[model samples]
Target: HVTLVPSHPSYAVISENKRQVRYQAPIHQPLVKVKYFYGVLGSPSITSGKHYWEVDVSNKRDWILGVCVSLKCNEKWNFLRPENYQPKNGYWVIGLRYANNYCASQDAVKYSDFQDSSRSTPSAPWVVPLFMTIFPNRVGVFLDCEACTVSFFDVTNNGFLIYKFSNCHFSYPVFPYFSPMTCELPMTLCSPSS
Candidate 1:
């Protein structure tokens, strides 16, 4: 089991028990439009080897899960948007939007088909619609520091692979990140079974 680090007091309001967290608006109130709210980091940064953890987001409508290089201090409020949460910004995360759409933090690329004359660019990092029609209540995160890979799993869905980040460059130690978005329900970190 891992402990949550209440790193962003303004962005992430942690519960007293430290098992749950809720997203909070910025205190400074920036003018720039923020697409994605901030989140808190888990304790005991992973510097090497492999680690896995789970989060219970059964009650949340919108949430984000993955890892980040470092948590931003509460004193400094940077107006962060969805585009800024990519690996380049030290964040490797995937999230569920309110509409139940899943997305990852990746560079937008255009895809063209040889037969079709249509060209499309993915606006959000690898946006994928949930075809299974069943959202996972619990999420599993696996990180391999040596392999530079981070993978997410739908624990409630027979441990199905939700998303994966490969060939990642972890310049700094990474910690588990969680965001409940605007949902009032608290996102809890699950304990290992005995």
Candidate 2:
């Protein structure tokens, strides 16, 4: 079994056992700054080979799970911004919002010239819907460094594929990331076999 690290409390409120984390303030709370509720990265970044991990998000209202570049404790980045979750920023994630929508982040594309096939336009990164399903109690993440792929599975449903990010460019070591947004329920890291 691999060890899983919870998010740092400075970025979010981590549980005593380091198995769960939550944003301190709710979205409707007054004077609550979004910057105070950033997500956390797991320890022991993956350098090569295949690795798998699972997170228990049962009864959680909002959360995000996936892999990201290992950021130092002292390093500063605006994770609260929407653009920070894109591949260009070293974040490839799938998340469930309060409205029960599941989506994957992707870079936006546009056709600069309608008549010309070669001309294309670049826009901000955005998310695309994968499907509409109830959030799984336990989500499994499989990362294949050599294959440049990251896949998520619904552990509660016969290990069904939730989403997969293929052809990912890994310039640096990456780690598992988790964010339980404003939900009191803990997000526990589960054994891959479980």
Candidate 3:
């Protein structure tokens, strides 16, 4: 029996050094959430710098997966920012990580293992306040890492929205950056995600 549960998020499992992954669901089923599991390819040479990581969405049929509306970084050790500020169209958020090369050093790893009994939850912001509002329906969130910068832009055109953040708080070694970056406008202002 195949049942859809709201608690179960869809996952995309990717291998190291792979550029693309695909997910196919029954034409009748609808997917609401997406999760990804990936491992960065390690380089033996100390000088091999990091590479920009990107995830792109492709539509196969009339069934469409909407643009990424929300993002959350998975809190894990060796995790870079898992989430990123949302991009509007065809663009990707790139250049996010601490170590310059694979052989240099590993990013700080958090969360002992999935089952470590002695686990510590990182502290949250002191204010616990809401973020700023950029568009009527969507809000823009930024992260500032001294090591790298993340930029987003429209895929159709070259127009870019460059966001800079400094001293951003991230607990994971590799931040699983998620983006809840979406627009409020329906027909005119925004194009369909598919």
Candidate 4:
């Protein structure tokens, strides 16, 4: 996904030769100290099979879709904070915050026990809100590294299966991550029809 992320340096208004990105509001950047601004687009790492992708987010309002663990193997965590968007330091996301508030993030993982694997202690980032009635204009991300899970879908409401980040603790090689959260529309990345 065109990686050039120096700790996301506020995404530099998102353009490293453009794959259609527009949505600013996190400017004022000049090396690290950013408190709350989002941008990360990473791909190519998967580690297994059963992969799928889609994202049009029609009339988008804020976005983020799952799978992480790449900044060349977690650069010692601190990818510019959202508390480190997490599933034990390697994120497995799901977002659409502040426009309708369809949230799901719980850094380092823990919140009613993110699927309860004997509640293996680790906490600090929790945003869980997801109570959808189906309003996903297009989003179908499914990664199953031998069933360690990372599923999110609504692909315009018929493929609805919106919240699922179960028991995932992949120790390296995980990709496909995005965050189009400021809005000028067009967070397009659709390639899943075959």
Best by TM-score: 2
Model 4 alpha-carbon drift over 4 Å, by segment:
1-24, 27-58, 61-66, 71-138, 147-154, 160-176, 181-194
Better of 2 and 3 by lDDT: 2
Lowest lDDT sum, 10 consecutive residues, model 4, at: 1-10
Between prediction 1 and prediction 2, the one with superior TM-score is 2
Q: Model 2 — TM-score against the truth?
A: 0.81
Displacement of the residue 94 alpha carbon in candidate 4, Å: 14
lDDT tens digits by residue: candidate 4, 8-67: 344324455444454455455554443553555555566886788776777777776677
Writing each residue's lDDT as its tens digit, candidate 1 over 83-178 gives 566776677888888746777868555575333448765455545444445688888899999999999888888888888899998876688888
For model 4, what is the C-alpha lDDT against the true structure? 0.66
The alpha-carbon deviation from the true structure for residue 54 of candidate 4, after best TM-score superposition, in angstroms, is: 12
Candidate 2 Cα errors over 4 Å, as ranges:
1-11, 26-37, 71-74, 110-124
The sequence of per-residue lDDT tens digits that candidate 2 reaches over residues 3-79 is: 44643334466666666666665455586545433677776778999999899888887788888876522345313
lDDT of 2 at 37: 33
lDDT: which is higher, 3 or 4?
Answer: 4
Candidate 4 displacement at residue 182 in angstroms: 5.1
Candidate 1 C-alpha RMSD relative to the actual structure: 4.6
* Candidate with the larger TM-score of 3 and 4: 4
